[model samples]
Target: MFKLLKYADKYKFYAFLCPVLMIGEVVFELLIPQVMANIVETIRLTDTADAAVQSAAVNDIFLYGGKMLILALCSLFCGSLAARIGSIAGMGFGASLRLGLMEKIQTFSFSNIDRFSTASLITRMTTDVNTVQNTFLMLVRGFFRAPIMLITALVICIRKSPDIAKVFAVALPIIILFLAIFAPIAIKRFRAMLKKFDGFNASIQENFTNIRVVKAFVRTDYEKEKFKKSNDALTAAAIHAEKIMVLGEPALILLMYFTITAIVIIATKSIAEQTLDVGEFTAIFTYAFQILTSFLFTIMILVQVFMAEASAKRIGEVLYETPDIKDPENPEETVSDGSIEFKNVSFSYGKGSDVIKNVSFKINSGEMVGIMGATGSSKSSLVQLIPRLYDATSGEVLVGGKNVKDYSVYGLREAVSMVLQKNVLFSGTIADNLRWGDKNATDEELKNACEIADALSFVESFPDGFNTDLGQGGVNVSGGQKQRLCIARAILKKPKILILDDSTSAVDTATDARIRASLRRLAPNTTKIIIAQRISSVSDCDKIIILDGGSISDIGTHEELLSRSEIYRDIYEAQQKGCDDFDSVGGAS
Candidate 1:
């Protein structure tokens, strides 16, 4: 909980001001009864003393009553101001926390980001943060004020009447007993409930992300069953938590009832025995009500504290997590030469077998090298290492003869641009998406990149041209067009090393050939590493490397591979057979 409280440090002055206002409000509230008691005693005059004496007493009571009313109004005004200040402080705290968490997320390395579930991260940032903020506000207003009010009431009661103080002392022990019996139980149940909530959230996220697959497979019933199971577990857990939390309230109320009854009976006996005055009885009754109000607030504070503790722990986990890929305290500057070397490189996600084992390679400036492999051959994983997305388990990855990890991530990524196979496009205009790679890119620069990627024709056809608004994930465009746009964005970067990882899979063979030709002619000075599945795609490359399983099976030009590499020859032959079969079917039709 202290971890979250640190967010309030910036607004410490406001936090202090809130308590001052609360104490003032409590002080005013406590004075109102004393004023009322004076008015009551003055009005209940016994022998109707001399007319002047009675008149003077009445005037004094009226003066006391006015002072009390004014004090009550002051308290009310202070409370209202406190609420406004507290809310503003809370909003500021929440905004700062949310921004800090988001920045932390952005700084995380790719491997560290992959460790967390997307849905869980979203929930922590939004729902859990909101819960903590709400608890903070409640603590500032109700939690802080309750104890002050209880303490003041206790002091006044002891000073004014010992009998009433004795009753409070007896009641205190009972409430303490209630705490001993239920506080731990409630805490245990609430923790279980929060765990169940995490499971419920994960289930909902899975169902939503896979909704299309579920519908296509006609597994709606199966999904519903899964949802029901999660829902039932959450419901049972929540019920248990609520039951435990509510237990204290009933026990508290019962204690108040019995205490009040005993105090009333004792006061009645004292009055009959000529040991208590009517005014004293009136004052004691008021004190008893104050005690009840104080205890009720205490229990409510306990509940908020319990829930806040749980939320604070979850938020702390994300904020304190150190990314697996750490930057050096003093990172070295990187000079862009576009040379890459992987020296005896080996990597695994964890303790599992290596995904890329004993891989070694060196590419000179402006060389166009291609990596060809079947799925799960670690082609994507290999390129991922070049940008230091994930560190190698052993051995060295170097850029321009310097260890990659020694360079700051920003300096390294600035010189390397990669267009991935997934082809992600954000919701924005064509210009907006292109600007992600080079924020200051002009209209002419964008057009040139689009032209190189063979995307100019379709983009020019759009109603808005460069200003065309792309739907989420570029859903408004065709798959081929999305791939072309991502390619164009990468091209606009004009990076020292350009990586295209199966980026042309969606484009037709003719368009792919056109794009490759355009790049070869225009980007001759850019070091390029192309990963592709089609043999035809990389046939013209200066060199090609074929990965079988996790190790490189062959490395040479197209002609050299066809002559010497069985895996390459077999893949080429299989693809030719597929084409022939397609041509035969078309002829038959």
Candidate 2:
């Protein structure tokens, strides 16, 4: 909880002013009751006075009351100023905290993000931050004011009569006893409520992300049932927490009623004996009620603190998480020779068996290499390390003869551009998407990139051409168009090393051939790596490497591998049959 205080401390000026205003409000509130009591006592004393004398006394009393009223109103105006300051300060604190958390998460390694879900992070940023904000506002208003009011009321009560003051002293111990009994239970219930909230968030996020899957499988009813179960669990936990919190009000009331009754009985007995004045007894009773209510409000604030504390801890856990992949202290930069080398590199996804075992490879500048593999052969995992997405479990990955980890992440990635198999397109125009690769690209450059990726014809056909609006995630575009756009974006980057991870999977054979031919002509200097399942995709590359069981089974030119490698031959035969079937079907007419 104290970790959240750093945000408040950043704008301490506002925090300080907020409480000053709140104290003014408390002062006005304190004076109002005392003034009202004074008026009542004055009337009680002058009950049988002559009309002229009584009129004079009443006018004097009204003047005093009115003075206090005006002062109180002035204090309230100051209090409102304080509240505005606090609210603005609290909002600033929330905004800063959110940005800090997001920046920290961005620096965290991919493995670290995998340890938690996206929904949990979203909850921490939104719901948990709100909890902290509400608590912060309460701190500004209640932290000092509650204690000051209770202490002042206590002093006033004692001044009225030591006998009456003893009543509150006795009640204090009993109230503390009830608080001690119930507070731990309340804290436990609040923690349970947060877990239920996480579960509910996870359920909603998963259903929304996979809504199409649910519909395709005709499982809408099943998904609803799953949602209801999570929702009911959260509801039950909240109700249980509410039940415990509700107990505090009744318990305090029960205690207040009994304490007040005892004081009333004792004071009346004193009145009968002529030991206590009617006015003095009424004043003492008012003071005692004020003290009790102040104590009750203080307890309510304590309960709220407990609830927000749980949320604060959740937010802290994410903010404080250290990235599994750390950058080297002494950095080195790579000059774009477009050379890459893997020396005895071994890696695993945690304790699982080695996904890439003792892999060794070297590529010269401007070489085009193809990595072909069956599923789970570690093709994707191997390339992921070159960008330092994951560190090698052993050995090293080098670019330009320097260890890849020796370079800053920004510098390292700027030289590498990847068009992955799962192509993603953002919500933007075709030109906007292409400019992400080269922000200063001119119209001619964008058109040239589109043509190289064989995307120019389709883009030109759109109503707005390059400026046509692409819907969210490019849902308005076909799979082939999305792939082509991603390729164009990568081409526009003019990276030293370009990677296409089965990027041509969506295009027809003719388009794929044209795109490859364009790349050969336009980016002859760029080092290219192509990963594919189909042999046709990589047959023309400078070198073809076949992966089986997480190790390179064969590495050579297409003709060399086809003639000598059994795995390559089998894959080539399979692709040949697929092409034959397609051609026969087309020629049937």
Clashing residue pairs found in predicted model 1: none
Task: Please report, in order, the local distance difference test score of every candidate based on alpha carbons.
Answer: 0.83, 0.83
Residue-level lDDT tens digits of model 2 in 290-395: 7888888788788778889988998899888888877679766554567899999999886788999999988887888999989889898888888787889999
Runs of candidate 1 with Cα error greater than 4 angstroms are: 46-50, 209-222, 330-334, 579-589
Please state every model's RMSD to the true fold in angstroms: 2.8, 2.6
Model 2: how far is 456 from its true place, Å?
1.0
TM-score of 2: 0.94
For residue 123, give model 1's deviation from the true position in Å.
1.3
What TM-score against the true fold does each predicted structure earn?
0.93, 0.94
The numbered model that scores best in lDDT is 2
